[model samples]
Each structure stands twice: as C-alpha cells, then as structure tokens.
Target: MSIAQLTVVGGGLVGAAIAYGAARSGISVRVLDQGDAAFRASRGNFGLVWVSSKGNKMPRYARWSREAVTIWPELHKELLELTGVDTGLHQPGGFWLGFSEQDVEARADLLKRINCEVGGEIPFKMMEPSELKQFLPGLGSAVVGGSFCALDGHANPLMLLRALHAGLKEKGAETISGVDVTEIRRDPDTTQFQIIGRDGQRWKSDRLVLAAGLGNANLAPQVGLEVPITTTRGQILITERLKPFLDFPTNKVRQTREGSVQIGSTSEDVGFNDGTTTDKIEWLARRAVATFPALANARLVRAWGALRPLTADGYPVYQGSTSCPGAFVATCHSGVTLAAIHAFVLAPWMAGLTCAPPDIECFLGDRFRDPNASFSHDH
Candidate 1:
C-alpha cells in the first residue's frame, strides 16, 4: 500500500474543523462529504458560541468545553484572516431562562455539581424577574427567574462553517462534497488505511481521522474502535429581523447579528427524523414570546429540525483504536463550542504526537460498559 498522507471523512463542523486544522499543518486531506442528505446539525444550530451548564456528569468535559470557549476568539480572527469571512462572533454573555422557581433551582443544582470542578463559574445568582431586567430589558414579567453566566456567547454557525470550508481550502485541504465514504479498510499488521468512496475511488493514507458525526459508529468498527452515538432531534424557529432587545443567548432563543431572533427548545427521541413540525415551531414561538414580549409580534422567517449527534452519556468521545493503530475517532455534542479545542488540541493528538495538554482519556468511546454495546452500525 502507498504511504497515506491524511484523509478525513466528513465535512460537518466536527470533521471540517479538525481537517482544516490538520491541513493547516500542511498535511494533505480529503473530506468526503455527503452534502444535503446528511443530517446537518450546523444548519439547525442556535448559533450560540456557548460554554455554560455543559458536562454536568463529567468535569473533564466541562473543562474541555470551557477551554474551547477561550480558544474561539483567536480562531475567529484566524478564519477571517484566511477567508475574509467575519463570523459575527459575539460574547456579551448567555442566559438560561426559567419560567418557575423550581426550574431555576434544578438548573442551579446541576450547575453546582459541574461548576465546582471548573471553579467559581458554575454558580451564579438566581436572576429574579427584577434582576433579569438588568441583563434583559423588556423581559416579559411572566419570566420567573433565570441564570446568567459570563462564559457564554453566540456566533453565526453557518458563517463559521463557511469560514472553515474556505480556510481549509486556503490551507490546501481537499473538500469533496457529495462523496460518501463506503468503507475504511485498515491492515491489521501494517497499520495502513484505505478510505473507499461509494464511487470506488480509494484513498490511501498512513493516518485517518474519523470525525463523521453520527456516521462514526459504523466506520469505527472497521478499524476496531467504538463510537457510541445516537440521534436526538432538535428543532429551531427563526423570527423575522427586528430591533434586538435580547442581549444574551438562552436555550430557547437568541438574536443573530442580522437582528433575527432564533428560537429553539425541543428535543425528541425520534430516530432519524429531521423534519420540523408546525406544532413544535408554534410551541417554541409561544415560549419565546412568553419570555420576551418583543418576540410576540415577530413573524417567523424560518424553522428547521436536525439530529443532534448525541452520546448516551452526553459527553464527547475521543479515542484511538488498539486494533487499528493509526486510526482515531472524535465526536461531541458541542461542536461549535469545542471547534477551537478540536483544532488546537485534538488535531495535534490525532497527528500521533505525544503529550496532550490535559488528561483526554476519559472521552474514549470505549468507556461504555457493554462489551457488545450496539450503535448506529448501518448509519
């Protein structure tokens, strides 16, 4: 087999970010993207460059997400420099709104456990309806309370994707859209990898990075790795451009730089369904209006549904295979939040260099207890 250079098999945020970073290092890369048919989490995203209330069950993941937040500004500048695309990156702050006292208390307790490890950032004052006015003027009085964290922000996710794609090419990465990778064959003894496309075009690379979003689980077993991932459908509602009244991003709504409000608050366990529903869109619009009355008259410009590439444990999975020496897999829920870390940190590690800045073993997909734990093998 010819000595492989570098071949990445996905073009969504996760794969595109890592591939762009690695290619920026001057390695040759081929990104086989499925294009429109692929469940594009990037399109349906709320576009919050957020970092609060993540990794509740695992401190390691919390620290990782926070690290990415700090690294994001530099990345935005780099992307703009490379592609002349300003990503509209903003970091005034973010909010988690609540309609009742119990909701505030519950989220507070959850943050309490996760924030202790990150230190000081986890706990914030419960935003009484009055205090909420300081952060969110014109907030509907019906809003019971909220939580504010300084460690959060928002950006145009599509612009981020556009910047990443252009920057990757500027860095000399080959991004092939609509090409589906059918197989990843690895020589058990030689550690050689050949990534075959559905059209029978084969790519031989000494190193392979599988960041294929929900498509990783099926690809991992061919290289003796595990990617325990499942799909959770999330929907979003976008309101017509209006004067911005909301300053910070909430889980249910965020105002984009273009002055359009983005509303999202639905998570369903439905499998492989990526179509938005009228009922859900209406429900989210109503919730957003309840929190911020300014949104009541705002006409909905768009709505969408897409699968969140989620793990059962709700933490990222980063691992290399014992059976396939040169192949590695990386997947996570917070792709936008963690794009910088994937570029600066995980890219280097996947390049086979030793000495990571922190302990990353916890993210290995193999942590699942079941020896035969099944995932989306056919996906």
Candidate 2:
C-alpha cells in the first residue's frame, strides 16, 4: 500500500471538524463520505453549543464540553476567515425550562453537581418563573422555573457543516463523496491501511481515523477497536418564520436566525428508524406551546427525524487502537457542542503534533471491556 499522510472516513460534523483541524495543521488529508443517503445526525441537530447538563455522571465530559464551548469563538472566527461563511453563533446564555417544582429542583441539583465537579467553572442560576420571565418575556405560565447557564448557546449547524467542508477544500484536502467503505485492511510489511470502497476503489494512508458516527460500529472492529454505538431517533419540528422571540436556545426549542422556532427531539430507542411519527410530533408541539404560549399561533412548516450516534454510557469514545497503530476512533452524540475541541484539540493530537488532551484516557474504548461495567445512555 502506498501510504498517504491521513485518511478520515465520514464527512459529517464529527469527521469534517477533525479533517479541517488536521488540514489546518498542514497534513495531507482525505475524507471519505458515504453521501446523503447515510443517516446524518448533523443535519437534524438542535444546534446547541450547550454545557449545562452535559456530564452528570462523568466530570471529565463536563470539563471537556466546557473547554469546547470556550474555544468555540476561535473556531467560529477561523472558519469565517478561511471560508467566508458565518456559523450564526450566539452565546448570550440559555435556559432550560422546568414544568414543575420537582423538575426545577432536580435541574438545580444537576447543575450544582456539574459545576462543583468541574471546579465551579460552569456558572449557573436557578431562576424562578418571575426571574425567567425577565429574560424570556414570552414564557408561558406552564414554565414554573428553569436553570440558566452562561456557557450555553447555539449556532447554525448547516452553515457550520458547510464552513468545515469549505475550509477543508481551502486547505487542499481531498474529499471523496458517495463512497461506501466496505473494508479496512493494513499491510503487514508497510503497516499502511488500505480502505476499500464498495465499488472496489482503494485508498491508502499512514494514519486512519474512524469518525463515521454510527458506521463506526462495523469499521472499528476491522481496525482492531470496538465502538459500542447505538442509534436513537430524534424528531424535530420547525415553525413558519415569525418575529424573533427567543434570544437563547433551550433544550427542547429555539428560534433560529431566520425566525423559525425549532422544537425538537424525543430520544426514542426505535432502531435506525429515522422517520418522524405523528405522536411524537404532536407531543413536541404541545410541549413547545406549553413552554411558550406564543408558539400556539405559529404554523409548523417542517418536521424531521435524525439518528443520534450514542455510546453505551452516553459519553464519547476516543480511542487509539493498541493493536493497530495509527488507527483511531472518535464518536460522540454532542457533535455540535464539541466541534471546537474536535477541530482544535483532537485533530492536533491525531496528527501527532500535540499530546492527547488532559483526562482523555477516561474516554478510551477499553472501559467497555470490563465484564462488570454498567452502562447508561441517560445523558
């Protein structure tokens, strides 16, 4: 196999961010994308750069998310300068509405624990309905209370994806689209990886990164790693363009730059069925209306479902293959929130220009190997 410098399989947010980062580091890079037919979670995301309730069980993830949001401004600036695209990042802060006192208390506790675990880096407040109303004038009566986090915000996800691909091209990185990677094999003598496409085309690289989202499940094994990934469908509803009302993003809803109220997302365990259901859609609509009564008059314009690439424990899996050197796997559900770290930190480490991020050892795939290890995707 004739080795190229680097090959990244997958071209969605996760893959594009890493590829863009590597290309910016002056490495020869190529991205193999499975095309539009692939289940792209990036397209259906709520576009939140959130940090409030990220890592309740694991403080490392909370810190990682905090760092990602911290560096997001730099990433946003670089992408705009390189590609002439604006990612629509707004970081005034965000709110998580609670329907009842119990919900409010639980949210406060979760935020308190996360902030404490992360050394009080995440500043938050438990706001009463009256206090929240000052920030959110249109808040409905059903919104009993909520938690406010200064680090949370949102961006235009589609534009972010476009800027990443454009940045990759500007850096002279090659992108092969509409190609289904069927196999990954390494030559014993040269130790170079040959990635085989479904059409029999082949590409070789000295370093290979498996950032194929859910597809990592099959591809990781060939590279001597394991990624226990599952898919959960998230349904989203978009209303007709209205007067800008939301100044910040929420866990369930946000008003976009174009004035459309985006309401979403039920975490359903239906396997690979990335299709919206009437029941879920109605539930989301009611929930949104309950959160903001002004939404009752908004007309729904679009609805969609996207699969989230989730690990068993709802944390990221960043592992470099011990058996297959130069092979790495990166998977996470918070692709949008963590895009900054993926591009700035993980990319440099993968290119061998920098050491791994601090505490990255906790995310290794080896954690799943323990027979007694319990897992939960509640996050």
Candidate 3:
C-alpha cells in the first residue's frame, strides 16, 4: 500500500486543521472525508472559542484551552494569508448568563476553582446584572448575574472549517470527500497503514491519524488504540439576520458576523439521533429571549442538531499507539476552540516533526480503562 506521507481519516475541523498544519510543514498529506452524511459537528457548531467553565475537574485541560485560544489568532492569520479566507475571529471576551442566583453562584465557584487550579491563568469575573449590562445593554431582567472570561470569544465556525480546507488545498494536501472509511489495518513489517473505504477503495501511508470524531471509537481499536468516545446530541437554533445587538458571545445566544443570532444547544444523551425537537427549540428560544429581551421579536429561521464527540470525562483523547507505531487518535468536542492547538502543536508531533507536548500524558485515552471507575461528561 502506497499513498501520501500522512493519511488523516476524517476531514472535519480536527482532521483538516492537523492535515493543513502537516502540509504547511512540507509533508504530503491526504484527508479522507466521510462527506455530508457523517455526523459533522463542525457544521452545526455554535462557534464559541470559549474557555470559561472548561476543565472544572482537570486543570491541564483548562490550561490547554487557555493556550489554544491565545494562539488561535496565529492560525487564523496564517490561514488567511495562505488561503485568502477570513475566519471572523473575535476575542473581545464572552459571558455566561444565568437566570437564577443558585446557578450563578455555582458558576462563579466553578470558574474560581478552575482559575486557581490552572495557576490563575484562566481569569474570570463574577459580575452582577448591572456590570453585565454595561457590557451587554440588552440584558433581560430575568438574568441575575454572570461570569466573564477575557480569553473567551467566538468565530464563524463554518468559515473556520472552510478556511482550513481551503488552506489544505493551497498547501498541496489531498482531500478525498464523500467516502466512508470502513477499515484500517497497520502492517507491522512495513510500519504502514492501509485505509479502506466502504466501496473497497484503499490508500496507504507511513503515518495515520484517526480524528474521525465519534467514528474514532471504532477506528481507534483497529490501530491498537482504545478510545472511549460517546455521542451527545446538541440541538441549536438560529434566528434570521437582525441588527447588530449582541456585542459579545454568550453561552445561550450569540450574534454571528452575518447578524443571525445563534441560540444553542441542549446536551441530550439520545444516542446518535441528530434531529431537532420542537420542545428543545422552544426551550432554546425562550431562554434566548429571557437572556436578551430584544430577541422576543426575532424570527427563528433554522434549527438543527449535531452530536458532540466526547470522551468519558469530556476532556480529550490524544494518544499515539505504542503497539502500532506511527498511528494516532485525536478526539474532542471542543473542535473550534482547540483548532489552533491541533494545527500548531499536535499536528507537528503526529507528523514526526517534533516531540509530543509535555502534558500529552494527561489526555491519553487509556485513562478510562478502569471498568469500575465512574465517569461524567459535563463538557
């Protein structure tokens, strides 16, 4: 089996960013995309490059997210220059609104704990309604308080995905779309991986990366990796383009560059059913209106659901197969927020250009190997 220098079996944000980064590093790359039918969380993304309440239990992940957002602009700029595509990144900070004092207090505690555990790098402010209103004048009366994180922000997720794919093409990487990868086999003697499609199409490469989102659960085992990946359907709502009212992105609602307000996301453990429900849509709309009274008059134009590729503890899985050298698996729900780190840091290591990040051990997939260990997926 012979193909490019690196074969990435997933063409969404995670795969594309890594592929683009490897290509920019002068390695020939090929991306096998599962196409439109796949559970593409990239397309249904809420577009928040957020880091406020992440890693509540693990400090390493919090710091990882902090580092990712800091370097996001570099990826954005490089992609723009290389592919002439704008990702619409905004880092003016973001908010997490709450309608009850209980929830607000818990949020404050979580943020404070995360900040302390991460060595005070994840700065946040617990704000009263008045202070929040200063930044968000459209704040509704139902909102009692919120937290603000300077490192939090948002971007056009679709644009970011587009820019990465465009940059992949510009960097001379091959992207094979509309194909389902059915199997992956690693030849121990040759140290090569053969990727087989559903239709028997096959390609091979010296290095293989399985960043296939939820699909990683099955594919990882093929290459001697154990990734415990679970899917949670997140239903989101989008309103028609409105006047620029939202100056900053919030957990519940955010106005896009195109003026449509993105109201999201209910984390339902419904097992791979990526379909929106009227009840969830109404809940989102009501909450958005409660967050900003101005949204009461907004007309909802679209609603959809996407499955988030989460680990047992909702952190991430970046593991290289010791049993099968040159094979790796990368999976995380924070694709948009972590795109920069994936491109600039993880890609180089996966392509054998540099050593793995020092903290890579913290995100290994085997952490969940204990069958008796109980886990949570709050991310």
Candidate 4:
C-alpha cells in the first residue's frame, strides 16, 4: 500500500503538537488553522504542566496526565533539537494554597478520592502553613495551610507552540493559516479524508485529526465522531516584571520565565464567552496578594481570557471511529499539561504505529454514544 497523506483539522496546541510528532515519524501531514478569530487556547493558557487533582472523577484522565508529564523531558529535547528553542520547562514542584480551614478540608477529601482511585501510585501531601514556609521560602502569613504535589511544573506555552510549528515545518509538515475549514468528508471507498474550506480549497488525505478545540463539537459529527466538548472560561492577568520570588505555580499564581507574574484562570461555567471580567481578575489578584503579600506591589500590566476545551467530565477524549476508521477526534483542557503525550504517544497511535495503552478504550468517544445511558448527559 502507498503511504497516506494526513490532515489535522486544527492548528492550535493539540493539533500542532500531534502533527509535529507525526511528521517527525516521517508521515506526510498538513494542519488546517482556523484563522485568528477562532478560540485559540494555545495562545491563552496558564502554562503549567499540572498532574495533581485532575481525575478524582476519572482515573483514566489522571493516569493520562501523569503519563504526559513523565514524557515531557524527551518532548522538550525534541523541540530543542529541531528549533533550538527552550520551552522554559521547570518541574521542581508546585503548591495549592488554602487560606481557610474548610479549603484545606476540601482538598484533603479531593486528594483522598484521587488516591483511592490511583491505588497510591500518585503521591501528595497536606502541608501546615508553618511547614509550607520552609519549602516555599517566600512567606505570606495569610496562607493558613496548603497542599503539595511533586508532579506539577511550569513552561512557556507560547514558546512550545512556536517550537512545535517550527519543528513540524523542519520535519516537512505543511501548516496553512487563514483557512476556515467549513467541512470534512471521508472518501466513500477509501480511508481518506477530503477537507473542504469556506474559501473553496479542497484537500484530500487518508487520515484526519479532529482537534478543533471547542469548535470540535461543530466539526466532529460529519466524520462519525462525537466531539462532546464544552467550554469553560478562564481569564489570566499579567503583572509587571517582578523579582523571581515564586519557585512553583499554584492555581492562583506563578512567576513566568520572563519574570512576570501570571495570575488567573477563573473556571466559570458560562458557555463560550471568552472575555475578561473585572470581578474575576479582582478575585485572582486578591488571592495572589494574600498568598504572597510582596506581590501587592506589582503593577498590573495586561489581562486576557480564553476558553478551556473541557470534556463534560473534565478529561481528554481521544478516539478513532470504526464508522470512519481513518478519522480521529482529540479534545482536552490540559493542552499544556498533556502536550508531551499528544506528540509522543497519541500521534503515534493515530499513525497506526502504536496501540492504545490498556486504559485507552475508556477515553473513546463511543463511551458516550448511548442516547439513553446515564452518561449521555455528557453530550
């Protein structure tokens, strides 16, 4: 059989990362980027490689994130090898601050559930405010207690996106922008995907990757896939360049590689509204300042908002349809957290080079297929 051409239906983090990995493996690939107006989370992410407290509700997701983080080093090396770009990845450790006793209790319970599901492979600890001081030398007395997870880390998301694009190009993948894909149709008798755009361009390929983020919901059904993905709004605030006081990232705040403080991420259930709000930013600033009083002096520089492409149950969805064998759908909120796995593991699977690991079936879109199943609420 002749080699097949592949078309990845989005140019954001997930699609770009997967395309880059596939290209590196010597597959011919093209990425369709829906121009700037699309909800591009790759440009708007917290940039943390987080692994703790992900899957209390979904163990498969928790495992996938852990697996993703474990492979990040090699992914970083691959990016550097191709483009000489360092993604500013740091994995020393990270924290979760709780100013109230109830906050501490909530996290304890959450972790307890997560641990019960994992059978103890994942480690976490509850730290007293005093105990936290030693590990985190920068002190803000208001933090009553907190949790620590060694698996969490940080990286420059923009740099990673740039590097992935460059590396994919170096590996001979074609990336086209300003193309609004209006339709994707599989060939009637072949394992090929015929991609059609609003601008009247036609693209034919043997495989398709549905990674259009929140837009996946709109594009998936045409190809026999259920991209039952939702959007959660998160806004990030940037502060003026500051002294490097934060060694690790917490949910509320962290210091960037460029010395700016990135504080944010309001997880509002409001659907598809990716706009920054004062109330959310104020809440984030108060929490950050409470965690590190020194940050009170930092000047606010900028703020922006993006929607997280979340599955209803808050895990990633990766599946290749039996209805359309060469068509695949991939969606996730942890784009930064799972970039490594997408590039290394998921990409190879889509290329027919590797089988889904033992737990992969649980993530397939078919699980949500039953219209009357209790889980059907997920759609």
Candidate 5:
C-alpha cells in the first residue's frame, strides 16, 4: 500500500502534527492552512498535557489520553533533534485545586471512578489543605483540597506548534498557507481527491485528511463524514513576569517558563464570537488569586479568547470516510494534550505505515448516529 501523496487541511496543532508524522514516515505530505484568519485554537491553549479527571465515562478515551502523555517524551526528543526547538515540557505532576470541600470530594470521587474504570491505570492522590500546601505552599485559606495526577503536566504550546511546523519543514513536508478549502471531489477515473480552494487553487492527492478544527463541521460532510462539533469560547488572562513560584500547572492557572502566570478560562457557548469579557476576566483573576494569593498583587499583562472545537461528549472524533475511501476526519478539544498521539500514532495509521491505533473505533462519528445517544462536554 503506497500512499504516494497525502494532504492535511488546517495548520493548527492537529493538522501540523499529522503532517509532520506522515512526512517523517517518508510520505510526500502537503498542508493547506487558512492562516491567521482561522480560529486557531493552537494559539490560545491552556498548554496542559493533562490526563487525570478526563474521560469520566469513557474508558477508551482515558486510555488514549494516557498513551498520548506516556509517549510525549519520545515526541519531544525527536522534534528537538529534528527541529532544534525545545517544547518546554514538564511532567512533575499537576494539581486540580478546589475551593470548597464539596468540590474536592466530588473531584476525588470522579477520579476514583475513572481509575476504577480504567483498571487502576490512572494514578492520583487526594490531598487535603495541609498536604496540598506542601506541594503548593502559597495556597490561600479558601482552598480546601484537591487532586494530583502524576500523568498530568504542561508545556509551552506556542513552542510546540513552532517545533511541529519546523519538523514538518525538516522532514520535507510542503505547507500551503492562505488557502480556504471550499470543495473536495473525487476523480471518477483515478479515485484520487482534488481539494479545491476558494482562490481558484486546487491540489490533488492520494489521501485527504480533514483536521480543520471548527472547519471540520462543514468540510467533513463534503467527504461523507459527520462531525457534530460546536465551538465554545474560552478566555485566558496572562499576568506579568514574576519570580518563579509555581512548579506545576493546574486546571485554572499555570506559570509559564518565562515566569508569567497564565490564568484562564470560562467555557461559554457563544457562536463564533471569540471575544473576552470583563466578567470572565474578573472571575478568572479572582479564582487565580484564591488559588495563589501571591497573584493578587501581580499585574495582569494580557487577555484573549479562543474557541474550542468540541463534540457533544467532549471526546475526539477520529474516523475514515467509508462512503469516500482515502478520506479521513479528525477533531478534538484536547489538541494540546493529544498532539503526540496525533503525530506518532494517528499519523502512521493515516499514512498506511501501520494499522489504526487500538480501540480507535470508539471515536468514530457513527457513535453520534444513535438517536438515543446522550453526551456531555464536562471534560
């Protein structure tokens, strides 16, 4: 099975990772990106490579996320060697701070259930305020308790994107920017795919991948796949550079490598309006200060909003088009957490270098075909 040419739509974390992986496998790959005009979630991410407390009801997703973080070191090293860019990965475990005992108890129960479901593969510790204070010395009195997962960590998302793009170039993958793909058609004589752009440019390839984030909702149906993905606006705030204080990333707050604290994010169901609001910003700031009182005096540097491409259940959608062979669609909210898997696992399978990842069937879009199917985006 020779995949002569492959094209990935979108240049965000998901597409870039797939393109890099395919190119690294010695397949000719091209990436068509809509450029800055696109709602690039890769730009505005929380940068967490987290695992615990994810996939509360789905064990398959839990396992997939665990595998992604486990192989992150390999991906990090390979990208550094190939592109000379360090991604600033730190996996010293992370915290999920809670204000009230009820919140902490609920979190603990959820983690316990997830661990039981995954057969104890996910390890976590439920810590009280005293125990948590040892790990995070600056915790405010309002912090009752929290959960810690050794598998949880974070990185510089911008650097990771840069490294992936750099690795793509180093591996000889071609990237076409400013291309708004409008149509996808199959050639009757050759069964090849022709991706048509709005600017009258067309590219043909043996395989086509729709990893276009929010764009997948529109593009997937064109190739016989349905991705019921919606957009949620999440606003993030950045504090000025301070002395190194935080050692691990949390669900609500994290200090970057340059010593700036990143506080974020409210999940709002605003349709395509990725704009920040004062209420959300103030809420995030107050929460961050409560998490670490030191942040109360810190200066806020910036704030912005980005849309998360999420399915009804907040799990990923990875499936090949049965109606149109050689066509695939991939969309997920955890783009930062799953970049490694996208590159190393999904990429090879898509490129025909290996079989699909074990248990990938759980992520098929057909799961949503059931009229009685219920879903949640809590993750």
Candidate 6:
C-alpha cells in the first residue's frame, strides 16, 4: 500500500521482466501497464531468441545477445518453477534462409565478423541448400543457402509474457493494468518520483524506469533524459493448426507448439500505423510457402501488425538520468532475445543492488547527442 521501491512504466515483457527481477531481489515493485489498447510487441513478435547476424555494427550488443540466450534457460526454469506456466523454450538452434547467393554470402561475412569480434563466442556455420536441407527437410528449391547458429532458438512469446506476469505476482510485485500514465515529476524534497495517470490518480516511487515501448520517447525527457524511440510497423500472419513440419525457427516463419505456423513480418517505417495490408500478407504467405511448401495448403487463420520500438541505431538505450538520479530509460527491438539479460543483469543495476554492466556505456542514449553522428536502425 505504501510507495514502491521501484515503479516500472510498462508491464509488457521488458518492464515485467525488470519488475520481476527486482522483486525477486527483495525490492518492492509496482508495474503500470497500458493493457490491450497499447501496441503490444510482446505478444506479436516472431518469438525468436535469435543471436545470429546481430550486433555486427556493435560488438557489445553481439556479446550481450549471446549472454542473454546463454542465461535464458535459467530464467525460463525459474519462472516455470515459481509460476507453473510453461514458456515453451526450445533451443535446438535455428536457421536463416536466404533466397540468393549474394545475400547468403553477405550473411556469412557478417556472422564471421561478429564472431571474430566477440572472441568467437557466437559460433555459426554457413550451409549450402543441400546441406541446409538436412536440418530443414522441407527447404524449397528456391533457397540457395543459409546460416545456422547454435545459440539461436524460439519460444512462445505470449506464454513468456504470461509467465513473467505470474512470476511478478509470486514475487509480491503490484501490477496495475489499463493505466495511461500521462505525467511524471520528481519531488525534490521527498526525493520520490510522482507518476500521474490520465484519470488524475497518482503513485510515487523511489526509483523509476521507462520501458514503455514507443511511449518512452515522450516520457524520458520528463525525467531529464533524452531518449528518441522510433517505431517500425511489422505485419504477421498465422495459419490454422496443421501437422508439424518446421522443426526449427527461421527469420521469417516458425511453427508453434500448438502446430500453428507463425509467418511474419515486414518492417515498414509507417510511423505508428500498426495496420496490416493485403500485399504484405500475400508476400508473407508466398515466402512461407517458398521456405516450407506444406504451408501453401495451410489456411491462414489470422493476421495483424505491431510496432517495434527501436533506437537510432536499432540497438538498445540503457541509460540513467543524471539530472533525475533514480530515473532510467530502456528500449530495444530485441525484447524477446534480451529479456534474460534485462532481468538478471540490467535490473540489479537499476535497483541499485549492483553496478552497471561492463558494456553499458555503449548502449547509453547519450550517443545520439552528437549532431554529426549518423545511425542506421536496421537491426
């Protein structure tokens, strides 16, 4: 009933993971979620805990993603044991199919560069279509080559979100839904952050975190931090339950445990328009069938779009506010892949229980302050 030690401004996967982690460490936590009205990427992602071809521009992120997948099983086991919710984590590696020889060669070069930069921590193998067909028996003739990473895997993203929420409850954290937080101000005398909802209700916390997806762009400046969050609308499609064919997840398609094929997605800079089009849906279906011919016969059951939160460079922005001492901002597109590190490593630092991660400086939003710096949000 009293002021929480830490209050998270988004109860999606990223915020829930942080709140659950801090709560497990004995910190009283409160989560404010926008509920169903928000553009929920947590439920709409491709469910890949992918690590290949990531962080080619930033070595720290490459290492961070690798670290995340390495410790994912730990969080998975802990959440399942405590909440009795299965996360459906299957980590038998994954493939990145390419339609042309040029793209496949480029992928190999990027993977090798990332691996060499990160001390060979991310081991990858380049495979021709014939070799790749061994792992993916349904590989279409259009596929020329691909790359495989042992650390890449997939999970049921909705179940992961459910399990994290359940774990938050089990750890004694408060989660408030349908709360459109409109304003935030720090009381200098009390040294507490005051959060005001749209309905004039309020709550205070000693520490505050902004992980509200695209909402972070507006909220961070209120706490004396400049975080520029960009949105890319990604459309996805799902097919009716069919016999299992996809044994491994790919960049474009993956079969869930319930036998439904999740086909996705197109990244468009449409600026907050989270709507799917017939063209993209048809394109996705064609690609899915080209990768796995059996999907052509599977009827599409659903289609939708969600916005992905990204920074200038398509990496993460994990920075604390210098003006508002206890305020922090976190945003990224790789929420599913980075969930474990965000909970285990990032939360402790935000809760003041430990120091920041060694490579945290590279992810700071301050990097965008340079007027001449050019960035690519292609991750």
Please give, for residues 1-379, the per-residue lDDT of candidate 4 as tens digits: 2247878988888999999878888899899988687788865698889888878767877788888998898999889987998888899878988889998999989887887798876689999988998877776888888888898899999899889989988999998898888888777777577889898999998888888898788788888787687777888899999878778888778898889999877777778788888898899899888888888899999999987787766667898888788888899887888999999889988876677766888887776777776541121
Global lDDT of model 3:
0.90
Ten-residue region with minimum lDDT total, candidate 5: 370-379
Off by over 4 Å in 4: 372-379
What's the residue-level lDDT of 202 in candidate 3?
Answer: 94
The C-alpha RMSD in Å for every predicted model, in order, reads 3.2, 1.6, 1.7, 2.1, 0.9, 1.7
Tens digits of lDDT, candidate 2, 1-379: 2235889999999999999999998989999999897899877888999998889999999999999999999999999999999998998899999898998898898889889988999999999989999989888999889988898999988899999999999999999999899899999899999999999999999999999999999999998897999988888999999998888888879999989999977889999889989999999999999999989999999999999899999999998888888999999998899999999999888866787889899899888889998999774
Per-candidate count of clashing residue pairs (backbone under 3 Å) = 2, 0, 0, 0, 0, 0
lDDT of 6 by residue, 161-220 (tens): 999999999988999999998899999999899999999989989999999988998899
What is the RMSD of candidate 6?
A: 1.7
Worst 10 residues of 2 by lDDT: 1-10
Residue 98 shift from truth in candidate 1, angstroms: 0.5
Give one digit per residue, the lDDT tens place, for model 5 in 122-148. 999999889988888798998888899
Q: Show the lowest summed lDDT stretch of 10 residues, model 6.
A: 1-10
Return the number of clashes found in candidate 5.
0
Worst 10 residues of 3 by lDDT: 1-10
- TM-score of candidate 3 on Cα atoms, chains taken together: 0.98
Overall lDDT per candidate, in order of appearance: 0.80, 0.91, 0.90, 0.84, 0.91, 0.90
How does model 1 score by TM-score? 0.94
